[model samples]
Target: MAKRLSLLLLRVSLGGLLLVWGVNKVVNIDHSMAIAENFYFGLLAAETWLPVAGVVQMAVGLLIIAGFARRWVYPIQLLLNGVSLAAVIASVIDPWGWFLEGTNALFYPSLIIFAGSLVVMAFADQDQLALDARKAPAPVSWKARRDCGQ
Candidate 1:
């Protein structure tokens, strides 16, 4: 029960973070473009694709929050977060700018977000609070399987 609750909290928090960022990308194009230019090599025609990426990210975030289609959503979330993390790896490694010029203290949270996404994906089956959990078939015990002589 504790495990389930913890996973639920992590899932919701991560989803919420993604949703907010996605919305920001759509609503504040200039800021999103700045971030892309600074962190993502201008994102290759970002003016055209940023908002589209934002919409897709928003959908993935919603699915993650609802714990729906976790098998697909979890991996998508992982990939998205992984890319973001990779972009900020310098800040994560030297957030104080001790040796890196572009490092920022604020970007360190990307590490935590990435870790949380990994945890959610690793424990997807244990998240009983997820919407899909209720629909999942119960696991058969070893005794039952043996009795059936499979």
Candidate 2:
């Protein structure tokens, strides 16, 4: 029970952080685009596409938190964080010869969260807390059913 509680706490904290970050991107899309522009290039430049990125983040965060779509949301979150970490590394290198950008050290926290996600994926036994708890049904057995007359 205590272990389950710890897992629940981790899931809620991680999920909440993602939801907040996703919402921040959505609410301040211009800022999001600016950051994206600084970190990325080419096809990611379109202004309209920028907001869509935020929307996707928001949706994925919600799904992960709700435990409604782990199989999909978990992998997507992994890929998202992995790509973001790569972007941070690129910025740190400044390969184009421009001055290196100040590291926000965001990647470390994200990597930690990514590790947490892996934990949840590996041992969560399902979603996390109330969401999965509520979804579970009582086990059925022939003896119980026979005693209760079905």
Candidate 3:
């Protein structure tokens, strides 16, 4: 019971963050574009990538929070978090002094949260409160009737 609750909480927290971040990216396209220009797209100026990332984040957030299609969603979410964590970690550890001051401190908490959420999802029931939570078909053996000592 407690475990389920904790997993649910983790899902909500991470999902909410992703949803907000995605929407923010969409709503504030200028800011997103600037970030992309400076941070993401210096090498590859594929205009579609930013919007695609927003859509993916929003979809992942909704799927994870609603607990729908978790078999695929959970792994995708894990990968997304890992990538974000890696980027932040890399920026923090850059010896070239390109990283902003105190950014590492800010990212440390997010990294911890991401790792914790990954652990929770890894062991979560995945079906709780999800659309996928349906009764599975009974076994064929259960359909057979037996005669008792007739």
TM-score winner among the candidates?
1
- Deviation from native of the Cα of residue 10 in model 2, angstroms: 2.1
Residue 68 error, candidate 1, Å: 0.6
lDDT of 2 by residue, 1-150 (tens): 788677778766766766776776768777777777777654455667766776787787777667666766778777776666676774435544357656554454656776787887776565446354444577989999999999
> What's the lDDT of the predicted structure labeled candidate 1?
0.89
A best-first ranking of the candidates according to their TM-score comes to 1, 3, 2
lDDT of each: 0.89, 0.68, 0.67
TM-score for each of the candidates: 0.88, 0.68, 0.70
Clashes of each: 0, 0, 0
Number of clashing residue pairs, candidate 2: 0
Cα-based lDDT at residue 8, candidate 2 = 72
- Candidate 1 versus the native: TM-score? 0.88
Sliding window of 10 residues with minimal summed lDDT for model 3: 141-150
Clashing pairs in 2: none
Stretches of candidate 2 off by over 4 Å are 90-106, 126-150
Instruction: For residues 75-97, write the lDDT of model 3, one tens digit per residue.
Output: 87777777667656754465344
Q: Which of candidates 2 and 3 reaches a greater TM-score?
A: 3
CA RMSD, predictions in order: 2.2, 5.6, 5.2
Tell how far residue 137 is off in model 3, in angstroms: 10
